[model samples]
Target: MVQDTRELNRKAVLTALMMSRPASRKWIAEASGISAATVTRAVDQLIAEGIVTETAEIISESRGRRAVELDVVSNRSFVVGVDLGASNVRLVVADLLARPLLALEIATPTATTARELAHWLASTARTSAGDVWDRVEHLCVGLPGAVSQQKRTISNAPNLAQIEAPTFLDDVENAMGRPVGFDNDANYALLGEQHFGAARSASNAAMVTIGSGLGAGLAIDGRILQGDHGLIGEFGQLPVGPLGTRLEHMVTGAGIIRRAAEAGIDLAAPSQLFASDAGPALKALRAHFDQALLIVLTATTVSCDPQTIVLGGGIANSLASTLDRYQAALEQNLRVSPRLAPAELGDFSGAVGAVVAALHKVYADLGIEEEAFVSLPGGDALTHERVQAARR
Candidate 1:
């Protein structure tokens, strides 16, 4: 009948099936909160379309007719996540459920043209993913800078200076013969936390990353807020302190070394500075964190009041021992305190976010609600007891 799976009942049925494999129509109805007739109708259509398969038969609890247990045919489709960084490129291929089938990482070549990058992507997928490449239904690319309006251009990435050609993204899409989505790497990292890490319950969150440079990914009302100019959540630009040091300068790896030098202390790395309990460098680093938080978190908290604030990147993760102080400092300064946590996913957050973005596109293309696929973490996700306790 070529029925579209957009109906609420169909979505419910699919979601129930995804959650519990090989379930009967009656079980799907109970789990999805849909009537048995609606589940049966949806299942029949899904099975016919090969989206779902009759896996087994079970005796009906009500002793009516033999119940046919149905499950999603995950192997029928695939999603691909490509993280294109200044230093490297990461590709992960997965089934419809976003379970990793293949993962590969390679140093990024100096490809000045988007067409070159596109060809590389296709070739790499074919070589690494093998027969699975044919089933890749959705793809997402993550990059260090903003994706322009309509996702046609990449901008503000100094590392990729040669990619000024506006036709780059369009050409890439054409080469691939399918739609392509772009994820700003900063926002994608935070989105990774929202879907799979600490910010699962946060409808609004500020994911601050202290790395080579500082930036934030703001999740507002369950969506990432990219500004009109694709500059939203660029918290690095926020200038604070007596000398007007920007957040980027205060919270980054280089910033730590530079600030410590000014204090007449030679610290090899953040790890070295964090090694001592009482030292001039340690005090300076703590002050830097405090000053930056006082400015950034105050502004972020009062403006948006994000339910949770997640901290990530090189500096934050490196200072694992003193993270409690970081959170406590935020609590001491802000008028309204929000939950604070460290990122669970470390280097691979952006790659995972690319996968989530690809799956999101798949759901939209299929006219299915997010509840049906849940490619990313949602508020309803079950988290570790310690994580939940820490948030409160």
Candidate 2:
């Protein structure tokens, strides 16, 4: 019974903390509907546990007293985020504050299986962080496929054909000996943008990743639209032109190579297609790219009606100038043109998103629940000090 009460008090205090920034014991007690005495006790315990800290002394409205403000000690914990792209794997270790302490980007060979890849990532994370691995409470991986709602397995990925079977989350957990979380790379990128980049203030937005494959991650009504099947924004497979010509086939780096080859443009690699020299071959390639962007923009506008579209991935970086050219074509095709912008976080967006998701999950597992500041009746709830003083 005591343990239950303590848990309830902890939950209350945590909820109050989440609703606002660092708060005083009086404020927390009032917001949580707990007694000020109980709030003090809970805060003490949390501080001892390294989860909360006494941040500052706020001048009270009272004549001479000062109130101590408590804040969540976010630095006490850390999380690992990994992004598994078709051609590369990137890993980042960040503190609970989501500050990246270490980052590793390695090429992912097509021949490597999912298990092999997971092991490599776990080992790399362990090596990069050196002695700080023990503080890492969660590991989140963003893959290029549908993740099970159970958050355990990768269902399918056409690009990652080597992963024949579902790569279970337990595999990574076992390898790293830590809790693991999984999400789609595109979805993770969207979360990163919302939390830390261009879409931070945008309520409705879409992130289009133009890489080895083209895909989108969408946010609607302030929440990510993962859909029932967890495949809300698989835009790559969307039929853009002929029945066989998917959006990915028309707009991705791979698509550029295929189109350039068809046009007899001498391009050894997709990256070379955007070389500085604007020879006849490069000029012809640019025209094909402009046409592809028109189709992509039209599809994005019609499907989501987002406030803005953020372009990301390997292709976006190489073709920054081409994006301007595409933007002009996009404006011509769209009935209502949403703002088009390059991704703010660049290639690290996916890893950053994974870190945010991991941190949220870690807080959730610790029984920390966030409560809104406003009550349902549109009134401020009384604090514990007020209630206690009234009782006295």
Q: Total clashing residue pairs per candidate?
A: 1, 2
Model 2 misses residue 202 by how many Å? 0.7
Q: Write the per-residue lDDT of candidate 1 for residues 1-392, one digit (tens) a residue.
A: 33543466677777767666668888888887787777888888778777888878887757567877787787888877777776667676767666667666787776546678767766765676678778888888777666675546767666665454677777666777767787577787777777777877788887776666666778777678776556776666676645777676776677777887887777787556555564765876777666775566666666567988877766667655665665676677764577777877665567667777887787666545664443342332222222233221
Best by lDDT: 2
Error of 1 at 244 (Å): 5.4
Off by over 4 Å in 2: 1-9, 29-38, 56-58, 61-64, 150-159, 168-170, 271-287, 319-334, 370-392
Root-mean-square deviation (CA) per prediction: 5.3, 8.9
Clashing pairs in 1: 195-377
Q: Where is the poorest 10-residue window by lDDT in model 1? A: 383-392
lDDT of each model, Cα atoms only? 0.69, 0.72
The alpha-carbon lDDT assigned to residue 318 of candidate 1 equals 64
Residue 106's lDDT within candidate 1 is: 83
Every model's TM-score: 0.81, 0.82
Model 2 lDDT-worst window of ten: 373-382
